[model samples]
Target chain A: MKEKRLISRRRAIFTGLTSAGALLLSGCLKKAPPTYGSILRLGDDLTYLAQRGLLSQRALVMEYQQTDITSFPVTDIGDPANPASTKAYSKEYEALLKTDFKDWALTIEGAVAKPGKYTLDQLQKLGERTQITRHSCEEGWSAIAEWTGVPLAALLKDAGVLASARYVSFYGFDKYAESIDMLDALHPQTILAHRMNGESIPARNGAPLRLRVETQVGYKSVKYVQRIVVAEQFVDPAQDIQAGWSWYNGI
Target chain B: MSASQTTHSETFRHKGWVKSAHFVITFAFLALLVSGYVILMSHPRLYWGKAGNDLTPALFELPISKNYHHGGWAKAIPFKNLKGSQVSAARTFDIFNENGWGRSTHFLAAWFLIITGLLYLLAGIFSGHFRRDLAPGRGEFSLKMLWRDLVAHFRKQSSAPGKYGLLQKVTYLSVIFFLFPVVILTGFAMSPAIAANYPFLLIIFFGHQSARTIHFFAAVLLLLFLLVHVVMVIRTGFKRNLWAITFGK
Candidate 1:
């Protein structure tokens, strides 16, 4: 009797699998084509924005100064190091170090024709320009950070961007993985930022290297980037291969 | 068949982890609620998108006949009038900012939930949570299952209990996919670097301000769902249903 009861219970569990709802929702087994695509697909719009456009993009990033170095809003995703997450006032500028970022290099490689690295000096050697760009974030707040970095085009030009280089994506060490497209990559305000608040980029704030893509939003400005790969196509292993992030995240 | 059935200790199940994750999320959520309430006491019934009030207390005699800093509430706690810089206002903001840490704690607990939920989801899938709805001996579909569940639910009968119903599956799947992702994305949409890095995300709901409004709304929805979920669990024979979730191996 116990065994029979268990078997009946088991049968009851998947009771929905055969329901009209599942049959209707699961598009895999149907012969008739879907009248509408999955609503899941629209969720990819932000991913799409992060992936395309150029030339038409604008120069809207802002700039900040040392004296104007006020409080950057405290992030809710507390640093893994300090889980207690003391308020901004209790925040310490612990990663403070003074170094001329002259030797730093921004490497734009992967799926590119001329995969090469450019030093801050070499990048400046290519041609230098600075802009006060607005930093828009998905977080719904905006701040102006004065950034001094090399032009993205200078690096793109050096890479000779292989014919297939479709997406100029960002690489960061923020423990976050985000990217952008060629349009914003080559935007005038878009830069490989080396300085913030008139000083070298601090480690906590994507130091050693960070991109200042001012037009679209902040997440596109990959920080703590050890390298940038100009892919023949925008390929996010974390997105397509892993848990999907929208291919384009332009807002 | 009897021998195939594994003993309790032998099989890895949610016996331990689910309980732990539940406790952590609950604890962190509680902390956030408490901190937020105290801080909001500084500014009762705050508004979104529009300008709102931030009331301060004035020092005076006991019974504390209070005055609204800007507006009034039907029945709000009043404090006596006071003199001097209102240190409590600053303290309130401090705690409000501090509550942001509760979000971090929630995420940490979320990490635990994702790990455990992953196991449950995977095991449920591979172990045929999807297939259990099908009859074991059949190559053909059964309309009987549907008729029975519909009848039972309509008549408010509890005899049809097995694991989860069709509606349960729908709700669970929606929560797992749509609702949860909305919460996560909206949460990220509030970061400065993130906002700067991905302004397009801000553009999705028109701007960051709107995204935040949506995030708050989603939280309220999740809270409502949680309340309903608890009630349903109790309605569906709390201990028996819980035994499956907690100790079923």
Candidate 2:
């Protein structure tokens, strides 16, 4: 009798759990209708397909030759409110762009063995590579911009990215500021682009320098980069949280 | 409910094709509740922007159009929001994929919920769940009755009006009929695809964003109502209520 009673109790608990689970799920199901989820979510799933491989390299990012791209114009800074503005961008910021960024330089500082400032020519001479990648935004807009620049891995290799560096914080001339995991920083597709669309990047487009992160949201791309600090930890651990952005915006 | 010309012990029964409709509506409404919520979570900071912007990618699959792919051969695809200022990004992680599918899913499910809800509403007029289960008798509306219900519910002292009392009817009437329509209407209002297809709805909804915000709250209200419904059922007797819904024993 005790065994029978226990079985009945277990069944009751199981049914109750199912019912509650069903209730929660059903509540979400009756929303804007199911077709919206079915139709739209499918198209935007290329990243999911790539990451999860709904279909392998059929989802491969298109590649382009550096010769096919235009130089990106400097329009904005990476961080509009970043307190480190003075230390981030000096007069060289304007002078570089004024000179068509022909003399602009990018410095990899903080926690790297070979912390050095790289001039534009120096960066290009490091071996330029181009990739035709899609930039996906958080706001539901997308664009295809061919980006040409030194591969992030190559740059990190030059600076000797520290083994303990967990994140690479990017400071840009645009109002935007962001950081990425070292893993993303070393992604083969991730680059510091100086050109776009077969011409110099427009000033409005984060010209002179921007981080092209193919795996994350547009907000994290950090246009108009001024400096990069590879660190063992986040400058702001809750930066993404405070910004209401996802820390893991992996495609 | 007061004993009147109506049968006092009249048990609720599923009428017409309501059994099938119930299952379909239940599943569809259930799905809407879930996937719709996933989309909502994507843009928890709500504003009138592109629906694609507001959704997630890994879980949902909304269809999106890019690069002026004209119709006929224009292949619709599910894509993630990619990272960039360019108009055709390859992919960014959203709660779901976008080819305009999440909204479509939400709309289709909402349409089903609304249509079936209307049928249930009409049916309620004849079936008496509204009358028997929800409508509070003359005494039910009084402040005293309200206090008594609160006390009875908490203290477990209230009498089960045999069929339903004032609380049950008012809750059901507001939730099943009133709230469902409002949510569905609000959802339609927020959808440009729907509004463009059905221009007349624009007049009713005023604008897309307005409908969106209102629709979100309406869902919340329905959820609240559902909570009350469950609480009351459990309070009254889970098995008895379950019997009424399933077997009406």
Candidate 3:
């Protein structure tokens, strides 16, 4: 009788395990996002889904006081004395820098009803929003800063974003580009920051204009803004996935 | 002879679900440790408070890589409100930065660990595994019993063939009830997206960098536990324990 009971219990355990495995496999098949070559990317999908589920659509990140702002890092900007040290530094950027970006203009064209170009003065006139929020990096560091900018939604509205647009892409003069979905595109906290800590953004920190995506990692906040493109689908920004960074990176 | 045989036959065997969870947790933990180590190799300094970088003073620095104090500290410059803060763009040496796969694997293995751990917790509660096997009885908490176990451990004296000693029970209980949960919570507290939605985690951990520092220490403790656990298993009839866990016999 004892042997029989053991057998039944073992059978039950196997049955339960098999069912659980089947359930997980089916769930992955149905709901898994883009795997980006490796099966481990499914974990990224799980994280994305879990975070989205937990966060309300318009949930705002914790804001800090001006005194709470910390010393923010300037990554990928390289030494100003040696502009060749960084990947983002270019002859064009150097030339623009020489005159304090007097001739630089931001172009908004793709999938917009009104394609146009705007100078710094014009972009600043659209609207102003100042927020002091923590900037979390993928490298396990975080710093709080007060950023002043025009809401991305305001810019999109002014540019007359088309109904078919699903993603908004930001291209930087530094050759870096990133795209965000509609949810983040319209988020009140998302802005094209023109100033940092009450001063015009330093060249080391994306001068003239930079994208502030408060909902995501710091990398999502592209710097040195040069153009904006509204698109139907996300354009993966140059080997970002192949290089093993998550495209969404909401955290 | 017959009585002894009966006692031997009735030796404790781990339950099926317990064995299953243990198997999954072992692999998941190994994955977490390796991937976590790889990720740590990229940036090995631990700090406290809301933010930290190479420029900030570290609470602890691991000597595993060249990333620690690479080329000394950058000179402090006047930042926002603070007078003379270190600039963060002064790294002189490139450390091991191939941590993309590490990050991916770490998250994946973390999911497995969390799911299996939660299931184990529920099963332990529902099946009375925690009560019967892990949790020490009221009488077992006596100092004499603990001292005896400690002395025996020092002398390399093994306990009864399959019984848990008072020391074993306490250690296992602490690991399950405290260490694992702390590690998982600290891990979640480091995520910006999670913190955005649940600021309570940040408050509980004190800050983002604090959470990271705590996570590192907890992981180190867990690794130490794993080392001791393996050594104990090997010393106390490795084949027998392995067979019992694998076959539930």
Tell me how many clashing residue pairs each candidate has: 53, 123, 0
In candidate 2, stretches whose alpha carbon ends up further than 4 angstroms from where it belongs are: A1-92, B1-249
Q: Of the candidates shown, which would achieve the greatest TM-score relative to the real structure?
A: 3
Return the DockQ of model 2.
0.04
lDDT of 2 by residue, B149-199 (tens): 677656555454455555555666677667877887665544322343354
User: lDDT of candidate 2?
Assistant: 0.55
Query: What TM-score does chain B of candidate 3 reach?
Result: 0.89
How large is the interface RMSD of candidate 2? Answer: 14.1
Task: Count residue pairs with overlapping backbones in model 3.
Answer: 0
lDDT by residue for model 1 over B1-249, one digit each (tens)? 122222223222343544554555555445434433332333233223211113222221112112124332222221122122211111112212221232233334444445555665565567665356322335232467656656766665543234355545555566756776676676555543344455566567544445555665676676777787887666655665566556565
Assess each prediction's global lDDT (C-alpha) against the native: 0.48, 0.55, 0.79
Q: In candidate 3, how many Å is residue B199 off?
A: 0.5
DockQ of each: 0.03, 0.04, 0.38
TM-score of each: 0.40, 0.42, 0.87
Q: How close is candidate 1 to the true structure, as a TM-score?
A: 0.40
Per-residue alpha-carbon lDDT of candidate 3 for residues B120-185, written as tens digits (9 for 90 to 100): 999999999899888888788888889999998877776565567789998999899899999998
> Could you tell me which 10 consecutive residues in candidate 3 chain A have the lowest summed lDDT?
A75-84
Question: lDDT, candidate 3, residue B29?
Answer: 98
Ten consecutive residues with minimal summed lDDT in candidate 1 chain A?
A88-97
